[model samples]
Target chain A: DAGVTQSPTHLIKTRGQQVTLRCSPKSGHDTVSWYQQALGQGPQFIFQYYEEEERQRGNFPDRFSGHQFPNYSSELNVNALLLGDSALYLCASSQTGTGLYNEQFFGPGTRLTVL
Target chain B: DQQVKQNSPSLSVQEGRISILNCDYTNSMFDYFLWYKKYPAEGPTFLISISSIKDKNEDGRFTVFLNKSAKHLSLHIVPSQPGDSAVYFCAASGAWGTDSWGKLQFGAGTQVVVTP
Candidate 1:
């Protein structure tokens, strides 16, 4: 079975522009979460989506938002991106109460580069 | 602020030796811990984990030891092989039933290099 998948392996945009990244969770999974990994740093939590509603969010600004579709796919949208927004966007999925300690499977991630 | 931290940015070890990576967290509410290994151009891969109740958890050559009182955990890879060369990340989550439990706080990661 295919694992979590993300679209647009890489993206480059200018400041004040908007960008949309897509993610498809692993089969049989329902929850989707997003993370941002900056250079030389670990992945930081962005937010999570469950039951088609946002379940939790991190310290990120309002410019970051996400949506979970009925099919368990997700999209992360960053409005008026800044150069600091350049980072690797990772998508993770977990089936509540199905895996070990809610182990999450992750996609390769979309590399976002803001110019 | 980063709740989880790996003080060591990188480590080098000889093959067939023991490798230990340390992680510390500032949040006491975290009960579940996990270690993930990542290679170039890939997402973090689950390695092993330990719950708060258990002080130790092992899988093959990989083992994790948790010290709740000290708020520290370490991942040990015995007889490390060349394939173990990669970046290892330590992550923690809040207790179940908490709103932030679904999101994991991760450390900056420790890069391990096994030299033959």
Candidate 2:
């Protein structure tokens, strides 16, 4: 089975500009989560989506938003991007939302560069 | 504030030897711990996990030991190979119920290099 997949392997945007990143969940998975990994740091949770609604979000500001489609694909939109927004955006998928034991499968990630 | 911390930024070990990476957390509420390995330009892959109920968990050549009292956990790799060299991240989550929502908090990560 195919694992999680993300689109726009890399991107470049200027300050104040917006960018949209996409992700396809792994086969047989329904929950999708987005993370931002800054250089020399581990991935930080952005938000999580389940059943087409956002379930949990991290400390990120309102500039960062996400959507989950009926097909279980997800889109992460960053408005008014800042220089700090330049990082690797990773998408992870899990089989269930309620189980604490479920392991998440990650995608290759989309690298975003803000100028 | 960094809830999870990997004090060692990097480590080098000779092939066929044992490699141990350590992690500490300040959040006592974190009960589930996990280790993830990542190569350059790739997302982290799950290595092993241990629940608060158990002090240790082993799978193949990898093992994770959790010391809840000390808020510390470690990943041990035996007979390390060059391919085992990668960045490792420690993650923790509270119980699924309540306000936790199963969110995972991650450490900065440690780079491990196994040389022949």
Candidate 3:
């Protein structure tokens, strides 16, 4: 089975610009979550989408938003991007309520470089 | 505040030796923990996970130990191999019934270098 897949392996945008990264969850998965990994830091939770609605969100600004399609695919949109927005955007998918932890399967991630 | 912290930024070990990676969390609500390994140009892959109910969980050469009282967790790789050389991360989340729904909070990550 194909694992989670993300679009635009890499992206480069200027400040105040907008960017949209796409992600397709793993086969048979229902939930989609987004994370940001900075240099020397672990992946931080951005938000999670279930049933086409955001269930939980992390300490992120309103500039960041996302949507989950009926096919379980997701898109992360960053408006008015800042230099600090440059980081690896990772997309992970998992089934909701699959016991505890709900191990997430991640995609290769989209590297966003804001210059 | 970083709820999960991996103090060790990197670890070096000889092949066929034991490698222990530690992680500590301040959030008592976190009950489920997981370890992930990542290679350059790739995303973190789930290695193993443990719930609050279990103190220890093992799979093949990798084992994870959880200490709820101390709010600490560890991942042990026995007889480490060169291929295991990668960045390892510790993550945790609250159960489903609670407000947290698989929203994992991760550590700074520990890079493991297995030298032959």
* TM-score to native of every candidate shown: 0.98, 0.97, 0.98
Which residue pairs does candidate 2 place in steric collision?
none
Tens digits of lDDT, candidate 1, B29-98: 9989999999988999999989999999999999999999999999999999999999999999987787
lDDT of 1 at A11: 97
Per-residue lDDT tens digits of candidate 2, residues B37-114? 999988889899999999999999999999999999999999899999999999987777644455778999999999
**Candidate 3 structure lDDT:** 0.94
DockQ of each: 0.72, 0.74, 0.82
Clashes of each: 0, 0, 0
What are the Cα lDDT values of the candidates?
Answer: 0.94, 0.91, 0.94
Interface RMSD, candidate 2? 1.3
- Fnat computed for model 1: 0.72
lDDT of 3 at A84: 100
lDDT of 2 by residue, A48-75 (tens): 8999999888999999999999999999
